[model samples]
Target chain A: MKSKTIKASATATLINELDKALSDGFKPTLAIIFSSIKQDWKAVCNMLDERNIKVFGATTAGEFIDGDIEEGSIVVMLLDMNTAYFKLEFLETSEKTTFEDAKKLGSIGKKTFSNPAFILATGGIFIDGEHVIDGITEGFGSEVTVFGGMAGDDLIAEKPIVFTNNKSKDNAIVALIIDKDKIDVRGIASCGWEAIGTTKTVTKSEGNIVYTIDDKPALDTLMKYLGVEVKLDETQEIVAFLNSWYYPLQLERENGDTVIRATRFANQKERSLICTGSVAQGSKIKFSLPPDFDAIETVVSECKSIKDNPEQQADALIMFSCVSRHLSFGALMQEEIEQVQNIWNAPMVGFFTYGEYGRSKIGNNEFHNNACCVVALKEKA
Target chain B: MNQNLQTILDFIQQSKHLSEDEKATLTKAAKDADKALTISEFKLVRTEKVKRTTAILLEETIEELEHKRKAIEDSNNALQKSLKELKATQSQLIQSEKMASLGELTAGIAHEIQNPLNFVNNFSEVSKELLEEMQEELEEGNLEDVKEIANDVIQNLEKILHHGQRADGIVKGMLMHSRSNSGEKESVDINNLVDEYLRLAYHGLRSKDKSFNAKLETNYDDSIKTVNVVPQDIGRVVLNLITNAFYAVNEKNLLQETQGDKYEPTVSVATNTMKNNIEISVKDNGNGIPQKALDKIFQPFFTTKPTGQGTGLGLSLSYDIVKAHNGELKVETKEGQGTKFIIKIPII
Candidate 1:
């Protein structure tokens, strides 16, 4: 099997990357991830239109796919898996999918696909990823594979976007069905950060704004843990210090140089910490600092093993990654992207996520805080 | 899934064409194909239609229940709001009544004081005139008229003291009524107390609103000697009624001013002695209470005054002051007619 890789720095650059991949006979099955910038959405959508590509993506706090974080880019990975049995249908209906709605929709989708199919969906407004899981569970009955993330808006993490093949919308949910006979998909989620330091409990918490932790103000707790004073006026510079090894607060990966586990949105006003996963009251939290050089090398080495596997030799691949890793590894994040490109030998596109969801290295549905999730889909044997 | 399966089977059956014998054989074959499927084809389809109809009915019932729940919640909120408004009105009415009674007592005291002062002014002028005339006669060689001059001086001095004492008596009466009249509760002889104040209050009113000609009547109870009361408070209540009677007559003068019709104003003071209590009333024939002002008359701070002349605290304070003594203060009045105030006190 032969593969192609597409790379772009910004959303405008995605069109050229796709054109190049398409020109190389890469019949692209598109997967995209994006952060919430009010601008560039329309431009990216138009570019996708000109390229005749169907988009499936969600608004995120930040996007990292295949290791690179696209601040304003729509990272599109185009794939061509020549399988006649696989059918792609874009379903767009106005009816809000309650449990009943999902059940109905699931039944319709199931009729078109065989047993052991994957139901990949993007959540609607105010819908949690759990609801999407629940809807798919009801519609297709208990015995179906379901996976997706609730959409996110930048660091605000408020309104989520559900991208259909046609356009981006706020109040819509989209599902992509993959039949078992058509594709064999394998998903793995991993991060390089290892839990270190003492634990901190979220003292005061609200939906996304966690104002304090450990009974102290959230910003104050972050400042104290990092040891160095950060000027809030220079947000990016202070955020750059998020992965500064001299004053690292995030938990580092014990096995690799993957993540620094950035404290994304901490609310000093409410005394709480809002990370990717569920942080309970009175739960202990520790910082994952930047990883060592050898750990970074180890992560690439492990991902290379996925390339060596006979089953993963797919015509295409899609990766979803956390954006905080880029700040932790700096230029090394680019190295991780290049490594995935060299090993997978396929068209790769993904966005940095606020949170990551994938099967663990041993295959269990897991919600990750700071990790990268790689899914390689190939023609079924 | 069930509906689709049924539709598919129906479609297959509708599409078939066969010879008469063949059709019969095929139909028989379809019936024996699967026992459960044969039963479902015959019985379950009809039952399923009924179930669908019932489900629609159930949906309607749920909607109706939700509507009723919302209506009940709205009514509860409305009822709570109205109850709060009612409580506020009751408290305001009670407070208003208290102040009105106090105003009436004050007006009575003012009228009582004014009467004696009018007499003092009238008599003092006469004394001044007599002393001047004596001085003139002495100046005209009346040195032998010393006895005459001394007699005149002593007579004038005695007249001054008489008028001075009358004014002092009226002031003392007011002070007694105004003092801690609510505190000193005692058994009072109702007939005696009413007769005394009626005489004093009437004479006092006649000195001021002189056009006030009310026929006074007394139906005093001789048997009921004493009742439980604060004497000073009881006296104040008597004074209030008498003063109100005189004012009612004065108001008639206003009607006379507009109509120019002669109407007689009469005040009747009566007391009935009972075995356990005594009832005293002061009735008047004049312009009575108007229908609109009736409800508000007993409310404090509510006045029909032109300002600077009256404080509307008479009847309300009287209601409380009377109620405090375990007695009733009642009124009977009609427009363009007359008014009567009846007070009943227990003989303990």
Candidate 2:
């Protein structure tokens, strides 16, 4: 099996680039990471002329390369790992497959492979990617770990793309299969945000739109909380913060503040937060989470500690940081990257995801938002 | 020493010769340049490929999205159509409800008119017999007997005419109730209208339940001149008030009967000319409206009556008509006692 790593330097042909890279080395397997302002799939196809190698990739909110971050550029990495002992599974579906389907799909994996990993396309926007991932988890059932990102657009409420082994379509879900004994794979996921403020009551809501709060319109309630009138453009800014800092409620009994997590927002006349999950009809809520650096540092520390386990080792770290946290700590983004790099010495790749999800470290089958969840993949002993 | 090779390479150099280490460094330095060139060439060849793929994918995506968009649009149209239909149906129902109540009232008036016609027929036949007997007595030259008989005939005829006139007044009131009054102000004999409305209103109550009865009093300002007012409209107002009072009294009576309490329900109609206006009141000695329902009494479509019995528009329409006439309609009531609706229409 032949493997190679090919990357872009300027605006040129990816075919020639790949051909040149493949010419010198032994035949190699490929793993490409491309970040471009424009659609570069044609260039990608030039690289994939031969169906000899399986491909898996995602669009990044921002791409990192050469020890620095680059926007609107494509970075392709083709490894020379062997193609033997590895299998690639492609999932294409129009009908929304259920947990039963995910389990059925997951059951295809070995009871225990020397090294087994699963990558699924978490829906980019509006779709519940976590639920999809959870379905896959049900298939694996603590047998194998899972990792992937809900595909993304340019944060455009416009058309978003989800790539599979075949094509990109609007109503499509995809999953990639990476077999055991091919590569020692590692995955890390985190949003790097903490719960702060007081919990709020989602008094009256319909689907994703919250009509009233404490029996008043949600917009008025939020304005009263902040003690300022919200302008139109600022609505998105408010919603983004609300999604990151509010709605998936939790009670802080000592302070009497109920935390809320905003799952989605209904784009109606009155913009409202679609809570991550349903709230009880009369539940009281508040915006409460400590905006402390120590809270963030703790996540970094926790992610690093996963790497120290003798049974597990880190080869690659994938971080899906919440876009709100990305915006909140604009200049501090590098610090977050650095902190992670210091902890887990591995090749890191991921995006500033629109929303982040993973099972809570606190426990339960529940997925979380606002906070970074780390998934570390190590070769099986 | 290698100038010949360098010069020759400069002239004819395909420049492919270099050590592995040197080549590695050169490729590393030129990776970005190499990547761009490869991207451009790859893009040209792959452009066609991407176009086909994108077009096909776009068609599929747009088709799916269009299907969804169409579904949403269709549903919206359907919902709007349904809403409009609902509104139309509601208005039709309200109009039908009003017509139904009017039908019931007309039937009651027809029944009331039949009673007076019977009286006129009975009295006319009795006078015919008395007249024949008087003629025979006159032929026999008994003048005293004839005089007494003649007197009796005249008295009986007067009773017939009096009862006939009262029946005529009630029939006229009922007829006016059916007609939408011009509501135009005219020189109205306030005293007479009060007197006429009193009888019709009393009859309206009696028609509802034969047992229902009320006392009426009038202290008309005989000295005061007639006022400009809509007599027919005012009469209907009085009629409605009386009917409502009768209902209240009837309800009280029923409740008392059930409780074995023997208390006769009484409604009183009174009229007094004040300084600048005439005040007419219909008071019922029955359970008054609750405090909560008081304010809402004049609101359209509000009723304490069971369905099919009241249209609930009487007071509301009366309120509106009175307001238009620049008159005041006021109600004073107490629980377990009585209620009085006072109407003060000004005379200008």
Candidate 1's residue-wise lDDT over B164-223, tens digit each? 787686667556654443477787777777876776666656655565566777777676
- Please give the lDDT score at residue A9 for candidate 2: 40
Off by over 4 Å in 1: A1-52, A58-75, A81-162, A170-175, A201-219, A228-263, A301-312, B1-348
* Worst window of 10 by summed lDDT in candidate 1 chain A: A237-246
> How much of the true contact map at the interface does candidate 2 reproduce, as a fraction?
0.00
Task: Summarize candidate 2's per-residue lDDT along B133-154 as a digit string, tens digits.
Answer: 9999999999999999999999
TM-score of chain B of 1: 0.52
Candidate 2 lDDT for residue A31 = 57
Interface RMSD of 2: 20.3
lDDT of 2 by residue, A315-366 (tens): 4455655544544444445566667755655555555544444544433333
